[model samples]
Target: MSKSIEAVKRKGKAKEATIESKDQRWHCRNRITLVFGSNDVEELETYTYEDGKLNFKTVDFHQAKSKAIEEILDNCIDEYYRGHVTEIHCELSEDGKSVMVEDNGIGFPIEKVPQVYSEFRTGSKFKDEETDEKGFLHRTLGQNGLGAAATCLTSDEFKVRVRHYNSKKEQTYTFIDGALKVKKTKPKPFKGHSGVRVELKLSKEVYKNDVVDEELLRKRIIDLAYNNPGLTFYFNKEKYHYKKGLLELAQRVDPDTAQEFGASAYIYEAKNTKGKKVKGKIDLSVALNLSKKSEEREKFISFVNSTPTFDGGFHHDRVRRLFVNSIKDKLARNAKKEKLTLVDNDILTGITFTIGVTMPNPRFESQTKRKLVRDTHLEKGIEELMNKNIDKFLRKNKEYLEVVMERAKSRNRFQELKDASKKARKQKKQRVEKLLDANERKKRELCTLFICEGDSAIGGLRSARDKLYQGGIALKGKPMNVAQAAISDILNNQEFSDIMASIGLIIGVEADVSKLRYSKVVFLADSDVDGGHINTLLTNFFYQFWPELFDQEAICIAKAPLFEVITDKGTKYIETPDELETFRETTKLKIKEIQRNKGLGEMSPEAWKHVLSRESFTIISASDVSRAKEMLNVCFGKDTSLRKELLMDEDSSSSTSVSVSSTTTSSAKKKASKAPAKKAKAATKKKAKVTKKKATTTGKKKAKKKTTTSSKKKK
Candidate 1:
C-alpha cells in the first residue's frame, strides 16, 4: 500500500490527513488523477476551468513556496490597487526564514476572518457586477480569494491580523502546519486606522532548506512601487517611493536612453474620435528611448489592472502594431519629401511603454493573470482611443519621426552590406572546395578534416595522415578568435574561409548542414597551452555559428598525446595529470625516458601515425551546449575585466582539470620527471627548430615574434 496526504479545512481550522490506498493514485481538487503507480509518488496537477483558466493543484517544492509568497503579496497589492491604501511595508526576517507584508487598506470584515484563511474561493472581490458611470469596469487585481487560503495551507506557521475602523472591531488568527491554533476577535479602540498584516513561514515538509531569494524579492517590491502610482513600499531598511509612475520607471530600467537617443514621453487620457465616452477607459504612458541609428536596444514592459502581464498578450500586441502603424501612416504622407521608407522596426528600435487598462470585465489567459486575452469589445474601444492619441502625439513631435526615418535607412543599408558579404563568402567556399584532392572527393563519406594550429604542426600530420580519407588545413597562426569577431571579419579570414570550404558547409545564419564535405571536423592542435587556446577559439567559432554541427557529431577535439611514456613493456600514452600519478604508483614495468610533447610539431611522423590513427584518438564534446556558450563568452568575450577575474580565479584554484564529455586515454601528464629529463628538454628545442626551418622552406612564413603562452601545458 502507498500513502498520500490530503488537506481538509473546517469552519475555523485547517487539517491534514494521510490516507493509504492500494491504487496509489493522486487526485487534484477537480477529481482529476494526476499520477498513478504501484508506489507512493509526488505529483503536481493543474486544474483547468471551463474557460481554459489553469491554477496550480500541487506545485513543486520551490514553486509551491514561491506561489505561497506571491499569493500573500497579491492580496496586499489588490487592496492597494483599489485606491483604498497608500502605504505598504514588507520585511524579511534577519535569519532569512520568514517574510511579512502589511498594508493600510480597507480591512476585511472581522466575522469572516476565520473562513477567509480556512476556505477556498471565498473572498470580497466578486461581490459586484455593474459598470461605473465613467465606463470603468469593476476590475480588481484579484477576484478569487484562494490566495490567502492557499498560503495558509502551504505554510508551517501562518498568522493574520485585521482591524476595521468602520465596524470598530479587530480580529487575529493563527495556524500551524495547516491546522488552526487560535482565533480571537474583539472590539477595536476606533481611534486607529484599518488595515491587514500577514506573516508566514513556508512549510519545511514541502520546501526543504529554501529561503526567499532576496534579489528576486527586491525586484518585485521595486517594480510594484514603480507600477503603482501612489504606492510607497519599505523593505530591508530601504524606502521605495514612486510618484511619477511609469515614466520614472522607464528611465531607471533603461538609463542609456539619455546618452543614446534623448528620451521622449507621451502621456494621454485616451478618448474616442466623437469625443464621447468609450466602453472602457485607458490611461497610456509611453516613455520612448529614441536612439541613434547604430545602437541596438529593445525593451517592453506592460501591466493590466496594476498586475503585471509578463507574456504580453492581446493588449501588448495591439499596442505595438497600432503604434508602429500610426507612425508609418504619418511618414508615408511625406515619403517623397523625406526620401525614406518606414518599417515597423523604424518606430520601435529603442522604445519602452507602460499601459494601464481599466475594464469592467477583463479576460486573462490563466488564473495567474500573467497574460491578457483578447475581447472584441475591449479591442475596438482601445483601438479608437490609441489611434486618436498617437496621431496627435506624432504631430506635436515631428523631429522624433526624422530620427526614426534615419534609423530605418541605416538598417536598410546594413542589410545590403550583409547580402554582399554572403555572396562573397559563398563564392569563396566554392574556390576552397576545388582545392580538395581526388582521394578526398572519392572518400567523402568517411573523410575527416583536421584543423591544425600552424604550418609547423601540419608537416608531421601530412606525412602520416591517411590522404584517402583524412585532410589537413594548416592555419598560419592562431586565426582571428571567432568568439569575439563579427561575421564580416570571419568571412574575410583566409583560414576560416578555407575550413568552411574544406568541410563543404556554409558557416552563417543561413548555414546548410546537408552539404557537409567531411563526416568529421576535428581540431588537432599542439599538446600545449597555445594549442588549448586555439582549440577553444575554433570550438567557439563553430559553436557560435554552426551549433547544429556539435549535435550531429561533426565537431570534435582531437586528444593529442600530452606525454609519451616508454616503459620496459611498451610505450604508453598519458592524457591527464591524475592518470599519470596513478600509473606511476601502480605500474610495475621499469620506467624509461618520458617525452613531454611541447607541440604537435615536436612529435615525429611515427608518433603522428599512432596519434592520428582512428583507434588512438578521443573526441572531446561539451557536456551541455548552454554551459559551453557561457564558458566561451566569459573566457573570450570583449569584456577584459571579466576575463581578468576568471584568470585570477584559475590561479587561486588547486586543480586545473577541465571537465569535458569524455576522454579515451587513461594515463597522461604534461610534465615528465623520470630518466633523461635533460635530454627531453634539448630534444624539444632541436625538434622545434627543425620544424620551423622545414616550414620556412615549404613557403610558410613563421610569425615574427612567438605568441605568449599563458601556460605551457594542456589536459
Candidate 2:
C-alpha cells in the first residue's frame, strides 16, 4: 500500500499505475494490474493472474509468466500442426488433466534442422502441394510456424515426434535451452494414431507454479472444440460440453427456422470444380458465442479441415468474410457508420457459427497457414469475383437455401431483440445524468412503466398505482422517438437517458441490454383507436430500444378498461360495465349510464388505483421486447396504411401474426434483400454500426412527429 501511494505521488504524467524493479515490470488499468515481463524464469512457482490482476500485496509473478509462456506454447503447437505435419490428434490423459494432441497426416521434412527453428525462417510458402493440402491463400491465424516452434523453445520438456503417415519416416524433437534437439524416430508399423504427441512437461520456467491445470486445459479444449469438431478431442475420452451448445445453434438453422425467418436463410452447396452444378452444400458451423464483432474468435481460430489456422495465412479468413458478407448482402442489413466504416458490428453479433470451405489449391503467403486466395463465390447475383458465384450456387440449391432462411427466421427467438441491438454504445452517454431525474424513477422490483397517451393519464396512473408495489410511472412526451434518433441522440434523450440511469442500465452507446435486470415493463393504454396507436408506440419503443425486456420477459401492454362501472359511494368500486348492467337487470340496483371513463385521464388517482392495481383489471399480453421486434413485421412491419387497413378498415384484412410466403415474389424479394451486414468488418475498423428497423403506427398522432416514410429502423 505504501509503495502504491508513493508511486501515485511520484507520478507526473497521467500514466496508469505502474510498478518496476530491475528484474520485473508491471502496469494496471481498471484496478487490474498486469506484470508484463520478468527475467527470472527458473524459480517460478504458482500463478494468480487468472482471477484477475488487482493491486494486492500477493501478486503472483509466476502465474503471469506461466500464462505468457502457455500462450507462446499454444502458438507453437498450432504451428507444428500446420508445419511439416498433416494429421493432428488431441486427447486428454486418463485423469483428464494432461492433454495430448498430435497429427500424422504430414510431417516436417526440412533442410538443415537449425534453419527450421530460426525465428526468421518461416517454412510457409505461398503454394506448395508438399506442405499444404490445397493453396491456403487467405488471411489465417497462424501467420508463421513460430507458434509451434515457440512452444518448443519455452517448455521444460515437450516432445514433438513427427513422420509423414504414409511415408513411414519419423523425426523426434524436444526443446533444450530454448532450441530444438532434432533426431529421427524408429520407423515402425503404424500403431494407434498418426500425429505429433506433445508430451508437455511443465518447466520450472513456465508451469512450475502449476498454472497449467489438466482440468483447465480440458475446459479450454471445449472452447476451441467448435473449431475442430472433426478432430476427435477427448478429456480422457469425454468428448466435450460444447456439443450441446453447438447442436442447439445448429437446430436453429434447421428447416423450421428457415420457415420462420421466411427467406433470410440459405443452405448453399456448390462444387467449385463443377461451377453451377449441384455437388455439395456448405452449412455454417455453430459458433453461437461469437457475437456480431467476432474479432476475438477470428483472431485466434480460422480453421481449415478441423485445424486451427493461427497464422491466418490460409483462405479461411477470406472465405469467412466473403461468406458473411454474402449473407449481409442478402439481408441489406449492413450499413456504414458515419459513412466511413466498411463493415458494421452486426456481423459479429447473433452468430455463434463456423463456416467450412474447402480449398484444393492452397496458395499461402508464408509457411504458416494464415491466408488463402480462393473466392468460393456463391454463383448468384454478385460476380464470382464479387461473391456472386456462391450466392448463385446457394440460390440454385433450394434445400440448403431453405436451411439458411430457416436460421435467419430466428429473428423471433428473442422477445425484445430490437430493444437489445447488434451494437453497444456506452461511451456516448453520461451514466450519472440519468439517475433519479424528476421526470423518471426506477426500482428493481416488478415496477413497470405505463406509457400512456398524455399527462392527464400519467397523473391518474401515478395516483392509481398499487401503493404496495414499487411501481414507477412516467409520461412520455414527444420522445426523441428511437425510430428517428441516432445512437448519440438516443442516449441523450430525456426519458431513455433517465430510465437507463435510474434503472442502473448502461444506455446509448454503452447499452448492453443483454445484462439488464428489469422484472416487468408494462405499456398502459386505453382500448380506443388512439389507445391502440399508443400501444403501438410503446411496443415499438420496447422492441427498438429496450430489447432486454423481451429477452428477459419483462415487457407487457396494460389493458386498462375502456368502459367501467363506478359507485359514487358505498365503496366507490370499479367493475366492468357488463357486470354493472347485469346487476341492474337481475337485482334491484339503481341503473345509470354514468359515462365510461373515456381515457386514463378521466379517472382520478384513486380510481386508477382500482383500475391499474386491482386484480379485477386484466393485463393484455405484450410482446417481449426482442420478440416484439421480430414480430413487428409479423404484427405491423408493413406500411402503416396496410396495418391500418387490416386493423380498422373493413375492405382488406391481414393477420397480426408474421407470415412469410415462399412464393416467387417473396423469394425474389428475399433473394434480393442480402444476408445482413458484415459484423466482422466493424471490429477491424473503429466506428460502430448496428441493426436498424422501421417503427410504425396506423395513423400519425399529435405526440410524435410524422416521418415521410414508415421505414423507421431502430437498429
Question: lDDT per residue, candidate 1, 193-255, as tens digits?
Answer: 778888888666555544775654665677677777678888877888877776665555445
Candidate 1 shows a clash count of: 6
lDDT of 1 at 625: 65
| Candidate 1's TM-score | 0.48
Candidate 1: which stretches are off by over 4 Å? 1-64, 128-136, 180-191, 207-209, 254-280, 293-297, 333-343, 395-411, 414-715
lDDT of 1: 0.63
Question: Each candidate's lDDT (Cα)?
Answer: 0.63, 0.41
